[model samples]
Each structure stands twice: as C-alpha cells, then as structure tokens.
Target: MHPEVAQLIERSHRLGADPTITNYAGGNASCKGAEPDPVTGSDVELLWVKGSGGDLGTLTEAGLAVLRLDRMRALVDVYPGVEREDEMVAAFDFCLHGKGGAAPSIDTAMHGLVDAPHVDHLHPDAGIAFAAAADGEALTKECFGDRVAWVPWRRPGFQLGLDIARIHAEHPEAIGVVLGGHGITAWGATSQECEEHALEIIRACQAYIERNGRPDPFGPVVAGYEPMPPEERRARAAALAPLIRGLASTDRPQVGHYTDSDAVLDFVAREHHPRLAALGTSCPDHFLRTKVRPLVLDLPATAPLAEVEERLRALHAAYRDDYRAYYERYADDATPAMRGADPAIVLVPGVGMFSFGKDKQTARVAGEFYVNAINVMRGAEAISTYRPIEEREKFRIEYWALEEAKLARMPKPKPLATRVAFVTGAGSGIGRAIAERLAAEGACVVVADLNTEAAAEVAKGIGGTDVAVPVSVDVTDEEQVQAALDEAALAFGGVDLVVNNAGLSISRPLLETTTADWDVQHRVMARGSFLVSRAAAAAMIAQGLGGDIIYISSKNGVFAGPNNVAYGAAKADQAHQVRLLAAELGEHGIRVNGINPDGVVRGSGIFASGWGAQRAAVYGVPEEKLGEYYAQRTLLKKEVLPEHVAAAVVALTAGDLAQTTGLHIPVDSGVAAAFLR
Candidate 1:
C-alpha cells in the first residue's frame, strides 16, 4: 500500500472506533495516490475512498475503491441533464479503475471536488451541534471565524458535490467546511493534517459551550414528573426486555437490547424530551439505520408487567400506522420506492431507554447514533432551539434507490439470525460445543459458567462481543442463576432458547457412596436445573413468544448401572422436570425437551474430573479404551460425538419439533437399550 493510503486507513480506523465521533457504519475517508493502471504499465492518479457496506474500524485493503481521477472530475461538466438517481449511480460505476473491488462511497464526487491530497468526513456529536441548530450558520461563523466555510443542507448527490466545490473555490484559505444538518469535512495536504484539523474544529466548538452557562434541558418542561434512580431504572429494563422483544415479532425473531447510556439518560430525563425527539435525525446517513424518528413509548415504573405488555402492543401498532402515513404523505412520482419503517429505538418515561437491532452489533450501532443525536440536540438547544433538516428531505434520502440497494445486496440470513440463546456450563465440553454451533447459525449467545476465565475465553473465541457475551454464574445458587438470566435479557433483548446442560457425573455405588458425593451430584443436577428452568420460563413468558428449553440427561437415567447411584437418580429427576415444565408452560407456547446420550465421555467434564480410569477398571477394560468399550456395546457400533449431541439440540430448537415436547430424544448412536417407546 502507498504510505498516504495506509495512513488514511489507520486514521479512519481511529475515528471509526471512537463512538463519540462516529459509529460502526457511518463516515468516509480518502487519499489521492498513484497506482499502476490495469491496462498499461504506467502509473496513474487515483482517488482511493472508503467503500460502501463495511465497518471502518476493521476495514482492510479490499474495502477501499480506486477510481480514475480524471473520469470522476469529468462527471461535473456533463451532469446537468441527469435527474434519475439510478443514472447518477451508473455514472459513478462507469468511472471505476478497471476491475477495482467494492463500490466507491456515494460521496466520491464530493471528496474529488476538494482540492486537497487528503480529506476526512465524519459526524462528531460536538461538531454536529452547530449544524443541527436553527442559528447554525451564525454559530459556525462565530466559532471558527473565517477559518471554515458553511454549506447549506442539500441531499447528497451530484448537485451537492458541485455546490461544495464552488464553496471551496470561494473560500480558498479555509481548512474545513461545516455542512448544516449533516456533518463536517476537513481537507489538508497530508493525512495527519486533515485529522488534526477535524479534531481542532470539534474542540473549538466544545470550548465555546464551556465558556457559556449550560442551559437546563428539563427545568420547566415536565415539572411534576420525576425520573427513576439508577438501580430502579436497571430493574425496569430487565423486566421490560421480554415484552419489547415479543411485541417485535412472532417468528422467534432474534432481538438485542441496550439500557440507557450516559447520553441516552441525559436525553430521556429531560422534560422537553418528547418535543426534541419528534424532530428528524441530524443527518440523512443515520435515517437509513435508525429511521426518521424513534418509536416513543410512555412506560411508567408503576405499570404492572401484564398491563405493560398489552399497552406496548397497542403502541407498536400505532407506531407502524404513523410510519406508513408519513411515507405516503411525502411520496410521489419523483420519489424512489421505500421500505416499511421499523422502530429502532424505544423510549420509556421515568424508567429508561432501549434500542433494538437484528443482532448485537447492529443494535449497538443504532444506539451509538441515537446517543450522538441526543448530545448534538442538547448542544443545539443550549445555543438555540434544535432544528433538524425537514422530514420531506429525509424521506427522499431514506427511499433513495442507492440506499435501498445496500439492504438488497445483503446475503440471506442464517436460520437462527434473530434468536438469543443461553447456555450454562459453557466453559468447555458439550455446553461449549452447543454454544458455538448456535453462534455459527447466527444466534447471539450468552456464555454462563462458574469459571469466569473460561467463560471469557469462550466469549473471545466467538470474535464479536455483541454476538457472544460472557457472565459468571454458579447454577446451584438461586441468586446467581437469576442474575445470569437478567444479564441475557439486558444484553440481547430476551432469551428464546435455554440449554440446561450444567451437570457432572459421579461413578459411585449405593454401598460405598458417601453423603458428601451424593449431595454434590444432586445439587448440580436436580436443584440447578429447577432454578434455571424457572428463571428462563419467566423471561420467555413475559416476551409472549414461545421458546424451547433443552435438558442434557444421561442414558443411565433409564438403564441403571452397578456403581451409579446419585448420578443416575439425579438424571432421572432432571428428565422428569422437563416433562413437568412442558405440561405447565404449554399454555404459554413454550416447549421443553431433553437429550439422552451415553458413552461420549471423551473430552467431557466427566472424564476430565477423574472418572475415566475408575470406571474403566470396574469393567476390566484398558483406561485408554474406555470410549471404545462403550461404543461397541451400542446397537449401531458407532461412538457418539459431542457434535452429534449438538445437532440434536439444534433440531429441537429450530422448530422442527415445534409441536412436539415433553419427551427426551436419544443421541447415543442407536442405543436400543436406552430408547424410549
């Protein structure tokens, strides 16, 4: 890579990783460099800009699109007659340097218009304060004096690029330009120079705010209403997660949730929050991700859970109706086709705030933009009333063919894309395998284990924190179990699948088994299963969406062995618990099932805990051949693998057996001796 191009990538990552300045999906950067032309051996000038549909923080070399400089500049001269958005996009497509990978950013022309070697464009909350205000142009002049130029908000397109080029020509000495109700752009001869100038512009605005007395955002707006304390706010979030997730859909949709961050609380606690939230987002870029306006729900701390769910359903319907009306109100022959508006953020009065995403990372991006919006609006209100770009302009941007194409290009979702799963004892062995499989199938996983380090390792292996979250929990402890359940709700909306797979095997005969060993076995198996089931059931019920609960039992539960006393008894009780819970939860649409597997002890906690040699010696078999000994005894003569057990778990949870529950499925490679009629 050219040195200037490498520097652009590094600086873009820095800005993208910082939530205060930009989000996972927004922002763009570019550098003018020279590369060998594909057709000839000669070097040519190229505009390498960040491409569409990739996160800037983890962007790679392939993510940048290289375009012929002269071709891009020529579009300005012959673009007067082009009115259709698709034709404009085609003009950009035709300018790509031969066989270049990825589509160039929609702002490619805007970057080319600036007469600088390096250009940086970002949406920082501090800088957007000036642009999103009613008196933004005057404030922009006051803060930077003559160092920056001001451009009025225009929909990003060929015309906007031409206007920016004209402004650059008018103010030749300016180092940066602030686009009203959009964002900021900084241009310099070097990458470092551009980044520094961008930061300098933001800090100047922040210093200006510090010098003036900050105005109270909530003083006279809602005088009688008081906000909940931090602890109560968290409690309310936990209780409301299921209802929100259920009201979202009935396809067992995977949903993720986030509580009030500092910026979120600051906005929702204000008395004038309703009026502020009614306005559109500061930038058109965010409209595609978070919609024009959020869905505001007036939930109070005093509302009962049942009543809250009913009210939430009504509010959801109303929000959808309003969205359709708005789309129809502004749409006409000139506007591009639009998609249905889905609510991305939820605001609850006196309780807290919540944001939803298809999965964990997407949900986080939505929250980041909403939080930035709140802060920018607050700053604008401090100077003057915040006035975002009008709704009609946002509608045009939201329905633009280019924006709609991004969503259309996305690959087909995995089978469990919208599901959230909780697995206990997920530090290693069978539980670990099950959790990994769920994540690979696109479900967000919550890894719970008594070993904190092991749980953290599993989470790290999953790659993204939003996709896999780690929490420490001792299953036998009621409080710990309940807390784990709450953690899942707070992290990923609510729980749809619960795997009660946290138990150990103890090989002891009734004649020699000590009370201590027996007690430990029952506590881990019977008691733990009871506590986890109750907590998971409550969450699934509250969502009003039926879910699945799978218990990992043993073949020994049905066919007793000579030395097994406590292990066999506990497994039996656990299986029965599944049937009992299924009977009771059926009215709520929740399914409960169990998996019975035998002799798959290799790599299992049972063998790792020192049962391998002891059990082998009793059967007069070599310790290393214990697994083989058990396999030959099965009807199919095949050893059961951890993956085999994992596949059964997936089948039951995937709704293949949606109408079937209450019975344990065998996964011991055709073990007729342990099969159920």
Candidate 2:
C-alpha cells in the first residue's frame, strides 16, 4: 500500500472512532493512489474508500474498498438520482479493482471528483451546528472566510455528488467544503493534511459557537431537582423499565433502563424540554440511532408505580401513532421500505433520557449518542435555534437501502442477547462465575454483593461498565434487597433471571451450637434467601415477562451432615421455599429452581472464610487434601468446581430447562446420598 493511502486509513479511523465527531455508522474517507491492476500489471489510479458499514475507528485494509478512479469519475454523467440508488451502488461495486468483497462507500463519486490525493468527511456536532444553521452559508463564510467551499444541501446521491464535484471545481483553492444541513468535507495533498484541515474547520466552528452561544438559565433548576438516592433511583428506573419496555414492542422485548447521566437530567429538566427535545436530532445520520425525535414522557418524580406504568402506556401509544403519521406523510416512491417505527429514545421530564435497543450494547450505543446529541443541541441552541436537516431528509436517511444493508450486515445476536440477569453475592466464588458467564452469553448483568469494591471489580471485568453494573447489597435488609432488585431492573430494563447464591455456613455439634452462630447462619442463608427471592419476584411480575429464579441450595439440605444443624436447616428451608414460590408464581410464568452441590469447598466463599480447614479437621484429613477427599467421597469422584455450579445456573436461566422447574440440579459430582429422587 502507498504510504499516503496508509496515512489516509489511519486518519479516517481516528475521526470515525470519536463519537464527539462521528458515530459508529456515520462519516466517510478516501485516498487516491496508483495501484497495479490485477489483469494489466500496470499502475492505475484507484480510490481507496471506506467501505459501507465500516467503522472508521477500526478500519483496516479490508475496510478500504479498492475502486478504479477512472471508472468512478466516468459516472459523473451516468449518476442518476436517489430513485436509482441500487444501480449506482451496483456500478460502484462493479468498478472494484479486485475481489476485496467490501462495498465502497456510497460517497465514492464525490471523493473521486475532488482533485486532492486525500479527502476526509465527518459529522462532528460542532460542525453540524454551523452546517444545520439557518444561515449556514453565512456561518461558513464567517468561520472559514472563503477558505472552505459552500454547497447547499441535496439528498445524497448522484446529483449531490455532481454538485460537490462542481463546488470543488469552482473553488479550486479551497481547503474544505461545508455541506449546509449535511456535514463537512476537507481535502489535501496528503492524508495528514486532510485530517488537519478537517480539525481546523471544526475548531473554527467551535470558536464561532463559543462566541455566539447563550448561558443555560435552567442549570440550577435541573441541578436542584434532588434525585432520589442511587438505590431508590435505580429501583424506580427498574420498576418503570418493564412498563416502558412492554409498550415499546409486541415481541415480549427484554427492556433495560439508563437514567443516571448529567446530560440526561439537564435535558429532561428544561421548562421547554418537551418541545426542544422533540424538535429533532442534530444531523440526519443520528436518525438511524435516535429516530427523528425522542418520545417525550411526562411522569412526576414522585409518582407511584401504578401511575408511572399507566403514563408509560398512554405515552407509548401516542408516540407510536405520531411516528406512523410521520412515516405516512413522508413515504414516497423515492424512499426505501419503512422500517420499524419504534422510538429508540425516551425523554422523561425531571428524570433523564432512556435509550432502548435489541440488546445491552445497542442500548448503550444509543445512550452514548444521545448524550453527545444533547451536547450538540446545547451548542446549537446557545447560538441560534438548532435546525436539523428537514424531516424529509431524515426520512430518507432513516429508511435508506444502504442503511438497511448496514443493519443486515451485523452478526446475529447470541441466544441470551438483551436478557438481563441479577445475581446476589456476585463479588466472588460461584456468584462471580455465574455473572461473568451470563455476560459472555450476551445477558446484561448486575453484580450485587456485600463487598462493594469486589463487586465493582467483578462488574468491570465482566464487560466494562455498560454490560455489567455493580451494586453493594446486603440481602438481610428488606430495603437493600428490594433496592438491589431495582438496581438490577434499572441497569438492564428488567431482570429476566435472578441467582440467589449469597450464603454462609455454621457447623457445630448440636450441644455446642450457640445463639449467635445459629442466628447468623439463618439470617444469611434463610432470611436472606427469602428477602432476595421475594423482592426479585415482585420486580419480575411487574415486568410481566416470565423469568427464572435460581436458588443455590446445598446437598446437606436433604442429607444433613453431623455438626451442620444451622446451615443444613437453612438450606432445607430454601429448597422448600423454591417449590412453594414456583407453584405460586407459575401463573405469572416465573420459574423457581435450586442447585445443590455437596462439597465445592475450594474457591468457594465458605472455604475462603475458613470452612475448608474446619471441615477437613472433622473429616480427619489435611486441609490441602480436603478437595480430593471430598471428591473421592462422591459417586463420580469428580471435583465440583464453582464453574460447574455456574453452569447449572445458566442451564436454568437459558431456556434449556424451560419445561423443568422447581427441580434441584446437583453439582456435587454425583453424590448418591445427596441426590434428589
């Protein structure tokens, strides 16, 4: 590859990866270079354009489609309007110099027409403020002073490419071009020069914005709204997430919640928030992620669950109807088929913004974009009324065939994608393994533990901050248990699976057992289990989505060992409780089950807290050999690992055991004495 082309690929990725400048699907770049034609063995000018659906941040050689520059330029006359989008794309594909298998960016013609060796384009929020301004051309002059060319907005296609080519021809000395109500473009002899030129234009726009923007008057009003504490707020978000999720889709969608950002609060608190937020996004590119406008929902901060649920249903109906009307108004022969009309974003007055997608990552991406979009809206509103590209333009981009192809290109979702799992005592041991495993299987996880730092670390390790969220929880406290369930709900819409794995053990001869030891054991194992199970069930019921509740039981629950009265009794209570809960909650589709493992001493919380040494002493074996001794005692002579326990939890929640509920899955290496009939 030519050094200049390599430089172009690197520079393009840098601009594409930055959400402040461009999102995952927006922006394009290209470099003109000479390459050996496969058939002729002669150097020919070729355009290395960013491929369709390729993210600039992660662009590689494969992402750069190699197209003959001569062929691209020849299309200037043959370029048809948006109605022939398919044909134009086919022509670009046909011009490929080799079997690269990547489709050239739809903007290849525009890039080819530019005389420079390198070209870069981006949809930076700062630049959008200038491009989408009513006086965008004047702003372009004010910012660049004729150093940059100006081209009015045209629906992006053959005509748009021709017009851009004409602009470049007219302004032969210009460093960049501002496409009014669209995006910005820059060109130079080298890739670095093009990148530098793009940044300079963006900085100029930023300066213009800083000079003309106004101060936010309601800054204190939003700041003073006094949100509920994190736990309560999380609970609220979780409680309300299912209601909103139910309204958003008919396929029993797995909904999650995201409402803890400063930008969200600021936007949601404005007195004119409904009108301002509903106006439109900053650019047409965002239409694919955020829809043309967010669904503005008015729910009081102090509203009860029933009230909130009712409001969500009403608002959902109105929002969908409005979306249908918008589509009906804009649908025409030139547009692609109308896609799903669901609103991806929800704006709550005095609360914050919530973004929904098919899975956790998608939802997070939407939220990140909305956060950036809010700042863009802020920048534009400060200077003048923020005007996005018109609705018709957004409609075209939203339903564009190229954009649909991008969606289709994404990999198929995992089986548990979009599912949310809440696990207790997830800081370490079997709980931690289960959390990690669930996240890997595509379920968003809430890591709840008494160890705050450990829980945080576990969450960070699972899938970064977005996929796994950590919350400090004490299962013995009713309020904390309920709050933790809420946190799980809010973190990922609503919890579809709950793992009750938090427990402790007490072992002593019946005569020596003390009140303190017995109380502690029962408090943690029995009362803790009850509290967590009850709270999680309520949240799941409210979600109106049938889910799973898995209790980590003990083999001792049925086959009690000597000197294990307190621990064994509590474990037994959990087994019976699981059956009762399953029988009662079956009507609501909540399946309750248990996993009984006899001697998973190593790496377990019980073992970590000195239970292994104590139990080894009782068995007349050295602590180092305790694990082997316990394995030898089982029928299969196999070690019961934390991962084995975790597998049972996964099996119960993953729809693999969909028909089998209220049953115990033993992970004790086939302990015949402890096995359930």
Candidate 3:
C-alpha cells in the first residue's frame, strides 16, 4: 500500500465509531493540489484521488479525482446552499473537461479544504454498527484498536472541519479521524498510502460486520430528510424543551426528565420497535433519558397541540407521578429523587429530535437514547423488535443501593437478567412472603415452601398463571430442588432468578446439644442450602445467564449466641463460602448474598429454643406473645417474619442488585436496627 494509503487504513481502523451511510452513496476519497506529485519532479501537479461515489470495498485509481486542492478547500468552506454547491460543481466541471471528466466526490471540496497531503473516506459497516450503539465512543474503542481520533455525531462540512482542527490541536500524531454517526476519514503522507489506509480500514469494518452482522431482514427503510424552517424550529424546540426534559428519568420510581427526538416519529409511526416503548425502556440508561419509552406524538392523529399536550401531560404526569409515589415508597435516600424531568418523550411526528437535558451530557444522553429507540422502532418493523422487562424490575436495577453507588462510571445493563424469578419459602414466612412481594411488584413467581400442599394450593390460589406459583422443594435433596427449578423453567421459559430458601433450624442449650441434632440441622440447613444453591447456580451459569444465590444465615455467626455454636457456625460458613464463591464466579456475573435473620419462626431448626423459646420464657409470656416481646427489642417495632426475610432475598436476586455481589441482609425487623437505636 502507498504510505499515505497505509496511514489512512490505520486511522480508519483505529476509529470504528463512524456509521457508514450505506443508505446514502458510499464515501469518497481523494487527494487534490494545485500541482501534481513531485515524483522525479514531474509537473502533473493536480488532485489525484478516488472519483465521486466509489464504494470503498473494491475502489480503483480510475475512480479518483485530480483537482486543485486549495481551490477545493476554499469552495468547501463557503458552500452554504445550492448557489455555493453550484459554484463547487462548476469548479469540478472545468477540472473534468480540461484535465479529465473524472467526477470528484460529493465531498471533494470538503477533502480539499482540509489541506492534508493525503485524504481518504469510506462508509464502513463496522463503524455504522458501532455508531448505532448507545455507548458509541466506548464501542468505537473496542472495535478499532487505535490510529483514529474520535468525534461525536454532527452534520457534515464546516463543523466537521472544525472537528479536524480540534484533532490537529489535540493529537499531532493523529493520522485519521472518525465522525460518530457518520464515517471515518483517513489521511497519510502520500496518495497511494492514503488509498491503502482507506482500503485497510474498510476491510477492518467488513471483517467486524462479517463476524457479528445478521441479515438486515428488511428492504431499505431509509427516509428523506427535509429541513425545517429555523425560526419555527427553534421556537418549537425551545418551547418543547421543558416538556421533553420532564420525560427523562433515572429513579427506580423515575425522578429525572430527559429529551426525546422528533426522528422517533418515523420510527414509532410504523408498526415496529415502537412497540417496545409500549413495553418499557430498551436499556436501563434510557430510563434516565427517555423515561422507559417515548410519549409518542404523531401528525396523523388530528389533535390540537394544547389538547394533545394536556391529555398526554396527564398521561405523562400519571406515569411520572406513579413513579414518584413508587420512589417515595421504596427509596430510602436522604434526598428524594424526581420521577422524571416533566414533559416526557414527545414525537413531533415527522420532525427530527426534540429531546432536552440539563446540559450537553444530559441532552446528548437523551439524544443518544432517541437514536437507539428510533432504531429499535425501525428494527421492530423486522422482528418481534422491542420488549422490556417489568417496570418493577427496572426500578430494582435503578435503585439497587450498591448499583446506585457506581453511577459515576457504570454504563447500562445488557438485559441478561430480564426474566422472572420465583423463590421457595415465600408467604407469611420468608418463602411465602417473598412470593407475595415479587408478585406485588411484577415478577411472575412460583412460591415454594416445604408446602407441596402449599405449592399446588398457591398455584391454584393465584389463578391463571399471570402472577404466582407455589411449589414445594425439600431443598436438602437434589431431586426436589431439580424438580422445582425444572418446573419453574418450564413455566417461565427460563428462570432468571433463583433464591434457595429452605434450611433446617434447631435450638439447644450448649450442654444439651447433640451430634445427631447437629447432623440433622447441617443436613437440612447447610446441606439443603448447598444442594439447592449448587443446582440453581449451575442452571443459571450453563444457560449463560447470570443470577443470584442467597443463603439464609443467622445472627449466631458473629454475635454472641449461647449454645448455638453448630448452627451459628454453619450459617457463618455458608456466608463465608458464598463470599468466596461470589469472588470466584464474579466474571460469570453471578451474585451471592446471605441473610442472617435473628427473629423468624416458620419452623426454627437451630433457633427453636435459643431465641424464640428463651424469649417466651424470659418475658414470662406465652410463645405467641414472644413475637411482640422480641419486636420491642429490634429497631423497628414490627414482628420479623419469613415474609420480611423473603423481601430481602428478592432484592438481592433482582435486576437492581447489579454490582451487589456479596452481602447478608439481616432481616431481624429492627434487631440489626436496634444497634442504631
């Protein structure tokens, strides 16, 4: 390859963010100067470059344009509209007739304006795919190793040159440039070198596309772009800013507002990915920017702006207000989060984007979201298109305490945990209770307690399968655990959630503790937790699905609980083992947390006599009164039940706990809280 061509390829390959306009004609590459190459001082001084509209894949020299570089650059700078464009056309007209009728690229003036020794451009599919991604810059880096400078999406021309100017200022070593949402620009020291670099970059893009691309599955859905009058456009855009901002959100129960793109009208007006907005946000970050989905506005719908806005406003307020109520209900932050900015997403029917933000970060994020949403809306025309996990699931992921802490650097979730989960032992007890909660939120659940009787009963009780399922699993044995998981997978198509909630419990004064009793507790509590956890984890890992594994431990591990050494230690060991297990399996994306509830009594195996029984005796009350007596000692004055513990299990297993890999929720009502008291 020519040295200049080689440089071009290296730079383009280095920048994978450019979205080739396959829908438009491909890119144009050229080198123009007032004079020809100085090879042996030959006076061929002129532009020798790829001709107009040449596909980069199989381009040739015969396709190049030889023009006066300075003239080309100067024209590119002033071409405001048809008049200037006509002037540029005339310059090339002279070059074509006298020099040769080689049609220069549509961007010929653009190429000449840059004043580089060598220049190249191409519409690479890899760059387009990367550009289409939500995290365009980061994805660009991953696809292209190095050599290209990054640029975000912008209209072509002067702004693009300004970008080049910035690149020159920033990186003197830069050989090429990438325009986000556009295409790559490569240049080198010589014509042949620049051509080779352009080809190399195209090949890289082709390779990436071949490796990952699926068929478009549709004929071209490209649409025409007509400019809107600036005065009306700006007036509408400014007027609509607050409305759009209100649409963006980040709270589980949304609180932030964001902007929406008018381009979405073309997308959602169709019968495609627009459906996803009906379901939910495409990605977690979308919630912060677009409020799960856009509140579509269409030109076909004969509605007044005020009426439409007012009606949708209530609709928007309904969602935002509902989300706000939800946030207030579940969130524990010192400062309350806003549900959404306000207006929510709006589609100006056929206009481009009208999304808003507090600043560029927010606005750009909102715009990026509209791009994805619009694309999905387009893609939806092809396949099932877009579907979202439940809103409650989104809330969980958004509000996860640990996940909240990583806001500064975290990207978005990949929808790996978008399915439903059903935990055993939900109800008034831990197992039974988790079921009701996961159900109350959105998960289609199968609540399994030792109650097989309860399992079938709850299934029948919840009715029709839209909601809950009660199953019985003697978690200590491999057979029952497998059966429950199999049934759950069969019912849910897959289990994205798994919480092993069956364990043994028994209490004894230290002197009276027996080996057989210890063996029984370990067999059921420790062994049961292990057997269930192992099977569940294997299924999740093998499915290439990441999930959560939570152990039911007790306060006996660390706190001083007399005569509960075996039970406490085993529970502690369970916690320790899972912590290590979490570390080892972190790359797999599985999370494991333990729960040590100090006061729960569905069937207390280890804590039967120590806490509950002793509390009854100490308080001089009947066993029933022990619940009230213990409630007074905890931080909150509520009786800790199996139900309460179950809620904690659901949180750890749900989408909200993205980074929360190792933790034990102490569900002793206020027992753990009492220490604060």
- In terms of lDDT, the poorest run of 10 residues in model 2 is 217-226
lDDT of 3 by residue, 244-304 (tens): 3333322211112222234443453443333445555533334545665555543333334
Task: Provide backbone clash counts, one per model.
Answer: 3, 5, 78
TM-score ranking, best first: 1, 2, 3
Candidate 2 lDDT, tens digit per residue, 1-677?
A: 77866887779778977787877767888888887888989999988888877778888888888888888787766766656755687788778888854777677767877777888878888887777777778878877887987788866666667777677778877888888777788888888888899898888888888887788822435443445566566656666776666555444464455767877776776665666677787566666777888887676666676876777778777877898899889887866666666678887654566778888667767777777677777767777667777788788778777777767878887767877788888898889989999888888889999999999999998867668999999888999987787666567777778888988876688888898888888888789989988887777777677788899998989986888888899899999989999999999999999999877876787887877877887888998898899899888898888889888888887777788788988889887888687
For model 2, how big is the CA root-mean-square deviation? 3.4
lDDT, ranked from best to worst: 1, 2, 3
lDDT, residue 236, model 3: 41
- Compute the lDDT for candidate 2: 0.78
**Candidate 1 local lDDT, 1-677, one digit each (tens):** 88888998898888788876766767788889888887796998888888887667877778988788888888767776537434666687888887766787677777877768888888887778888889889988988888988889977766666777787778878888888888888888898899998888878877776665267743353432345677777777788887787765543364756757666665665667888888857776666667888877665555676777678888888877888899999888866654555577777766656677677777777777787888788788887678999988888788877776777888888877878899998888888888889898888899999999988998889867788999999999999998899899888888989998898876767888999889888998899989999999999988877888999998878877779898889999998998899999999999999999886777676777778777887788998898898889888888887778888889998766778889899988777768786
C-alpha lDDT score of every prediction, in listed order: 0.80, 0.78, 0.54
Give model 2's TM-score versus the native structure: 0.89
Instruction: List the lowest-lDDT window of 10 residues for candidate 3.
Output: 249-258
Off by over 4 Å in 1: 80-82, 218-227, 250-254, 299-311, 332-342, 514-516, 655-657
